[model samples]
Target: MDITFLGTGAGRPVSGRNVTSSALRLPAARGTFWLFDCGEGTQHQLMKTSHKLSRLERIFITHLHGDHTFGLPGLLSSRAFSGGTTPVTVYGPKGIKQLIEMSLSLTQTNLEYELHIEEIEEEGIIFEDEQFTVTAAELEHRVPCFGYRIVEKPVSGKLNAIKLQGLGVKPGPVYGRLKQGLDAELPDGRMVYANEVKGPSIPGRVITILGDTSPCENTVLLGVGADLLVHEATFAADLPDKAVEFGHSTTIHAAEAAVRAGAKKLVITHFSSRYRQEDLEQLADEARVLFPETLAATDLLTVPIPRIVEPRE
Candidate 1:
């Protein structure tokens, strides 16, 4: 899985960045991209990337703020003409359904595909499939905002070709079973256990995306042990009071939350418009003092999620 920051600026568009929208590309795992927060001009941003609008399978809105969800109607409408025949599901808080329906209703928009809107009222497991499970939790925000935790399911290990060859297992359908960690019996009545020819299973990745919020216990709880924690840093660390007043987080708050949660990597976005690209980089540097693996996200920035491989001595 990978993340592409379409717009990293907070509140509104600025010189260097647009509003808040990010795309989680899972082409190999789920055969589609999941859009997290579709801010104004998000469809326009997608036009600039190589991603196809038709491949958007789900949209997870963090809040009802215009900066996070104003572009929903336009994008949903545009997808109908962009060869998107598959059904798309949107997951968000209580007002999300009303927002989408009202926008589409007011504009008299007709969609070719079915749009499923899941308005979450409480925090728990929101989405689960064979490949991944998505959980939601309440965050400390101005409104009833939420954060999403995506946990990918563990995958089978690679087949040991040398070990298989050593056991005289020819390349055939039996290899498929062995690769799936199943025992195979040879024609000579010799049974070969899958463990003999299969490496260790690959652990899945965990990604947490938090919306606009102040420092809270739920933030740390939801973000705990994530492979990547995408937290909001809307202000410098020195302006904690102002950040709290605005119901946003500072660089220090975000970094502290990541550290408390024991996240492996932290990528800070939702930057205030007052700061330029260089200033944002400095904020990232400040966060790095607390959480060394911190990154400041900019528009169109893609972060590939690293796999947690076991160390072999």
Candidate 2:
């Protein structure tokens, strides 16, 4: 799996940073791309990248802020012209349906693919498929907002070819059968066990995305031990008063939450346009003091999921 940060600026677009948008790519799902947020200029951003618009199967909007969803109508319209035939599902707050309908109607634009929109106000599990399950939680923002937790069940462990070869097994359908945990029988009535060939299944990966929010109980709960925590750090701690007034977070607060929640890595984004490149890196450095694995996100940066391995018995 890989995560691509399309835009990370908060409120407004900066020269280097665009806005709050991210694309989650699941390698196990034929490179399925799930987008989060669609700030202004999102279609242009997609045009600049090699990402296929058609692979965008699901789009989850954090809130109704212009910085978060202004690019929806344009992206939706362009998807059809850009060779996107598969139906797309847009999940957001209640008024999203009305807004999308109004925008499409006012512009006299239509879509070729089935555009499915789901309105979410409450918290809990909101999405599921063979690849992943997404849980939504209400967040403390100025307006009705939500955060999403994406949990992915991984594939079984890699087949140990050397171990199989040592057991006099040739590479063929037996390897597939062993991976499927099926024991094979030989002509001599010998049972070739799957356990003798396949290793233990690896643990699933949990990725939590924190939308614009203040320090909240559920945020910490959902972020606990997350492989990656994408949180908003709109300001520094010195501006705590301003952060509270604006319903945003500081770098210190965002880092502390990740530290307290035991997240493997902390990715701080949704930065205010006031800071420069050096300043964003400084924020990441500040987070490193508490959590060594920290990243200051930029547009078009893709992060591959860290491989996990279990110790042999």
Candidate 3:
């Protein structure tokens, strides 16, 4: 899994940064991509990356703010012309369906694929499949907003081929059965347990992406144990009061949440346009004071999800 930052600016678009949009590319899901937010000019941003509009399986809108969702209508309309035939599902706040429908109706845009929109009313597990589960939590923002936690299911361990060969077990369907955690009967009528030759299961990865929010307990809870915490740092460290008043967070607040949540790494975006590139680097440096594994995201920046491995004895 990898994340590509499309637009990392806050409130509006600027020269270097666009607005709040990011793409989570899941290589395990046949290279399909899931969009986190669709800010203005997001379609153009997607054009810069290797991602295809047809490969966008789902979209998760953080809020109804223009900076977060203004690009929805255009992206939806453009997808039809870009060979997007697969059905797409959108999950967002209560008014998201109305927002999309109004835009499509006003523009008289017809889509080639079936569009499914789901409005989230409260916080819980909103989506779940065999490989992944997405949970939503209400976040502290000026309007109704949410933070999403995507948890990938654990994967099975690999079969020990060398061990099987040492045991004189010829490679055949018996290896397949053992890999499925079933015991295999040998030619000598001895039963070989699967656990004896199987390594430990690999832990699943967790990613938490929050909307424009103030530092709150819910943010901490949503980001707990996440491999990457994508929080908004719209202000510098010195402006705590301004951050709180505007219902946004400073770099310090983002670090605080990372510390409380025990997140492995923090990647902050949605920066206010007032911050220049050097200033954003300074903000990231300051955040490192509290949480060392923090990165300030810029447009087109990609981060691969780190795998978890058990400690050697």
TM-scores, one per candidate? 0.95, 0.92, 0.96
Using lDDT as the measure, name the better of candidate 1 and candidate 3: 3
Best model number under lDDT: 3
Model 3 TM-score on a 0 to 1 scale: 0.96
125-207 in candidate 2: lDDT tens per residue? 89887867899988888998888888877667778889888777787887778888888875567778887777888878889
Better of 1 and 3 by TM-score: 3
Question: Model 1's lDDT to the true fold?
Answer: 0.93
Worst 10 residues of 3 by lDDT: 24-33
Of 2 and 3, the candidate ahead on lDDT is 3
With a 3 Å backbone cut-off (N, CA, C), the pairs that clash in candidate 3 are: none
Q: Write the per-residue lDDT of candidate 1 for residues 161-264, one digit (tens) a residue.
A: 88888888999989988887889898999999998778888888999999999999988998889999999999998899999998999999999999999999
Give each model's clash number. 0, 0, 0
Error of 1 at 288 (Å): 1.2
